[model samples]
Target: MTHSSVPAPSPDQESLFAAAAADYARYRPGVPEAAVRLLADVLRGRPDPVLLDLGTGTGQVPLALRHAVPGLAHIEAVDVSRQMLDRARDALAPVLGRCTLTLVHAAADEYRPPAPQPGEVVRQPDLITCCRSYHWMPGPAVLAMADRVAAPGAAVAIMGDGSLWSHDSEWTRALRELIQAYLGSERRAGTHATYTEPRRSYQEDLATSAFTDVSEYRYPVARTWTPAAVVGYLRSTSFAHPDLFQERHEAFEAEARQLLDTYTRDALQEEAVFTVLLARRPGTAS
Candidate 1:
């Protein structure tokens, strides 16, 4: 089913995750291992390669890739939410000593590559990764910014599967309906943002951008979730964030638990096909 493009959350709307940062860190799934391997291959022979990760929520992508690519020299992780960045910092602590890490609190499109310091040489980033959160960015502008800052052979990987609320599974269907019943039938995102099905696909956006060479890799993975985990994950999402319920938060949870329990008894597994859309400049090797 076609849904609206997830709009970039405005200043006020960006506050949606402010209170849910902790839940976000604890519940959001890790980047697929296959995706990390693909990224590692891109930086394989490059010396002291730097990675620029946009919308680095909880720093999950970097955390997952640290062991996969021990030679990675640095990472610039940018996000607009201070709360999310805080949890990301904590989550990324293990790898801080292994690689230079810079956490920038700025919108994806507003952040620029860091300037070089005296006697210190800074090379363009070798790889860029945006997972799950690219929908929150201004697509064309961010792509343009990436093209301007990337190294000669650099590639951009935009990765995501639809959120649980939008998945087509039976349980997810009921969960989405429950949320709609509470927050109105329209899907809610960020604070005031509502999802509008995009007229153009992300592939189309990249095809017209400076990075016109693009390919997609899909990994079909089955995941199991408990009732509590499902509810916790919901709290981390923009559409079903707890604040939307306000005074009814506790009451809503009680009902949601009852609803989820019915499905978790025998099976709580769903097949989520994670897709990584890799885009590179015209002359870059894929």
Candidate 2:
């Protein structure tokens, strides 16, 4: 990553993540280790691969990959929220001595790693990951940027899964309705922004970008959530962020707890399916 040129995100977009950083760092589930292995395969020939993780909220990608991928020599993690970066720094502290870590407090679009210093040798990143945070980025523009900063065989992975509010299970359906009763039917995100579904999928976006070899993988996961855990998870998300409830925050939590308890008494856990979308330069060994 180079520091010379990068685009900035709108203030509204930047502030949307302001309040939830702590919750996000505390409660957002990690990317599965299996996913890290796939990422490692994409960078097979690079002896000391560099990683550039965009929208790297709480540094989850590196934290998950550090132990799984042995040759990762450096990681440049970027995020919009300073608070999120703060938490990420704390989480990454133990690994600092082993890996060259750079934490950038800028929106995904506006971040660029500094040029290598004198006596330093730097290569374009072998893997660029934007997990669960690609939706916040400027789609094709970010891909174009990746094409510039990535190595010839490097891969760019854009990943996420539908959240609790979007799950279709009976209990989840009821949970959605409960959330809507308080926050209305439209999905809200980051402060005042409402989610507007992208017109194209990440596959389509990558197909048209410079990194044209696109592939996707899905992982089915089962999660057991205590009522307290569920509440904490909701606080981490943009749609059900705590501030949305305003004066009704406590009431909403109480009702949400009761609703989850009633559902769990019959079925002990919730299950979800997660997907990972990987795009690479043509001819890369995947």
Candidate 3:
């Protein structure tokens, strides 16, 4: 709530999200409450914990945690997309309580929080989070940055719940096929590229970093989406973003809504496993 340093994001074209930021702000789901409680539990024992969130699209994680974590001194939310950062700042400002919030417009690996203000207690981030965004970064460099700046024994938590595009359900399958018919067989990424599966797992990447010890947590997540919300969610995604559909986005959305209506009278459901990989230095305990 107090400070900012100004600059998605992909591994390229940070402005790719500029056009869709409004949709993203309106339609993108916040992290499940379970994730919030889990993190609150993680920091409950620390004297005063600070959190750094990388690739913080719309600042959902930080915004959710703003009032939950006890003695949480500060939050640094870093993202490459200016528009997403704008949405984040707006969303977080109203709810931010005792904790200091910093919105940084920069890449994860390149960002550093400001020096503590005069009369502010010294602080270093004790928890670093990358929610639904680790895959879009230079994993090694970002991990290295976390190692350099995070407090000793600090934890790095990486969170992801699979996208609707990958869910296995009648409506989702139909939607995928519909997207392929318009955009082609491969999933789109950013502006002019396709999404490629990661060659190595996140665990493997963490094992090689300074925060080498890792543990995983899974929370069952169920979401219901209205046809209109689905269309808005698609607009916020890189794969189904309006830009990817060329001139056909409006037509595609119309068809998608109709297709969704055929599947359900009101809502489409998705069951997902929200996975958190909590990493720490050797012998460190959360």
**TM-score of every candidate:** 0.94, 0.93, 0.93
List model 1 lDDT by residue over 37-151, tens digit each. Answer: 9989999999898888988888888887777888888888887777777777787776666687777777788777666678878768899889987887888989998988899
- Angstrom error of the Cα, residue 81, model 2: value is 0.5
Q: Kindly report which residue stretches of model 2 are placed more than 4 angstroms away from their true locations once superposed.
A: 1-9
Candidate 1 weakest lDDT stretch, 10 residues: 1-10
The C-alpha stretches of model 1 lying farther than 4 A from their native spots are 1-10
Off by over 4 Å in 3: 1-12, 115-122, 265-267
Task: For candidate 2, list the clashing residue pairs, or say none.
Answer: none
lDDT of 2 at 200: 89
Q: Distance from true position, residue 171, model 2, in Å?
A: 1.5
lDDT for each of the candidates? Answer: 0.82, 0.80, 0.84
- TM-score of model 1 (CA atoms): 0.94
Query: Residue 1 in model 1: shift from native, Å?
Result: 43
Q: Write the per-residue lDDT of candidate 3 for residues 1-286, one digit (tens) a residue.
A: 5335533134365756778789988898888888888887778788768889998888888877776874787788888887888888898777766777788777887877676679976667889999988988889988998998988879999999979889999899999999999988999986778999888889988988998888899999888988999998999998998878779888999999999999786569988999999899998885
Residue pairs of candidate 3 with colliding backbone atoms? 1-101, 7-105
Q: What tens-digit string does per-residue lDDT give for candidate 2 at 54-96?
A: 9888888888777777677888888777677777778877875
